[model samples]
Target: MSDEFTDFHLEAGHAANGPYALDVDPQRAGWGYSSLRILDLPPGGHHSFATGDSEWIVLPLSGGCTVVAGTGTGTDTDGTFELTGRESVFSGVTDFAYVPRDTQVRIASGAGGRFALTGARCERRLPARYGPASAVPVELRGTGNCSRQVNNFGAAGTFACDRLIAVEVLTPGGNWSSYPPHKHDECRPGQESELEEIYYYEIAAAHGKEGVGYQRVTPSGHGRGTDVLAEVRSGDAVLIPDGWHGPSIATPGHAMYYLNVMAGPGETREWLICDHPDHGWIRDTWPDQPVDPRLPLYEAPAGDAR
Candidate 1:
């Protein structure tokens, strides 16, 4: 399946006055048929909803929020998990998913907080988190940029989870990250493989200016030179149903971050990519290289970039 890309502009406080507007559907974006939204809640207000699809996930990018998630099969409602704020989440620093055919859920913000939501359909439900026994954390560090961590979830779990696998990549500087293009659209026999994917981005800028960045994804193979370039900022998203994606280029002015959620029909969810033969080896050469010194991970109190 090939992916599609579309740009959206969401006003910070323009939510409809009803329960909740279906908002923006990313599935319609020509990717894996998913939906995403950045929801704003009034202080002490509550938003409770269910997904029409078999799976869904709710993530908090800023502020605090309380969530109640259950098996959806139980009647008593107490058989649920309660998560408060980003620090208390079981998955990504500010993200988590709710799976299975139908799961009833509710979320509320205490004072100020917004959520970056991403969901996709799947044959089965993948566990919320993986590893802990003896999982090693790999950190990618750069200047002005702090370190980003990757917990080999699928690797440490020994592939016990479902088809939907994930990894956590954090960025601290307004730096160009996720560089060195890679792809996984085709499955190789035993050694290399591919999987269609969608990237859900989350970012936070300083007090004034809005955070800004760009992403590039291109197809691999001879004569397949199509490419996609998207300028994505907070609440903006891009999809990669099939192609090599990289260099989530962040403006060298503010600190930003994003989470890459991916899954496919393939048996394994490992992060495997067939590089552009032209630059595939760059990944092997970055061990001794230094991150670009011009990148700015933290944003100035000034307004967002135009």
Candidate 2:
């Protein structure tokens, strides 16, 4: 692929720091508001981080953890939270903990695990909170081979954040999601909302081999050019600063999962999008077809692996 594709696609090592398999801050990503980082911890491993001016949620990708947060640099602990995580992204939904801005957070887990720090630069300093997996809304969208499951754990309607919106999408093997090629890079009343997005991938391995999938993003021709059609795997990521993104495809036998973190400078926090006119009609056909039977892959109560 050309730079148009490569520019948006980030290989595993291209974005890493310590235990973070993927780290994209507003500055590093050349955008504002949205940012994401996935941390991998070994058994009994502990890592401390500072949430300078960003409000964040510690969502688990695997395993459990204990989070201790404090306001001051010294030892005046402000709050502590326990997160009962899941076995993997393919597992059921997991509980999460939110950390306020300008705070220090220390995370320690009894067993190894991976955590997604979904965040957004914000002016508000809301109180730290916790969200249970049971409370997360799981939605099934599209139909047939286009069917997908969405865990709106940190979505605008699900979680109360100053500006952030995060969600996890699971597309069963051979299915497609993020369909109809939608764009949210323009703020059109009753039409669309402007938002920068980050797509972090985790594809399930097949037959003892590394899994593989595909992602697509085309420029909306609004002066913010971005074009990409990249092959992705576990730990890979795609950035959508401005463009129409969709059709995250899962190959046969290799289910796909992506964590979407989005935010922008909009006055309100919402996820409104406009589908490509050519493919917009796909939405109309969904009503006639049955949803893929392989849905609700796993219930929220898979006996928390943590």
**Highest TM-score, which number?**
2
What is the RMSD, in Å, between candidate 1 and the native fold over all Cα?
Answer: 7.9
What candidate 1 gets wrong by more than 4 Å, as runs, is 1-27, 31-35, 70-78, 87-99, 125-138, 141-161, 166-168, 172-174, 189-193, 202-207, 221-226, 290-306
Superposition TM-score, candidate 2 onto the true structure: 0.93
Best by lDDT: 2
Give a tens-digit lDDT track for model 2, residues 123-176.
988878778888888899999999999999999877888998999999999998
lDDT of 1: 0.50
RMSD after Cα superposition, model 2 = 3.4
Query: Cα lDDT for residue 276, model 1?
Result: 64
Worst 10 residues of 2 by lDDT: 1-10
lDDT of 2: 0.88
TM-score for each of the candidates? 0.68, 0.93
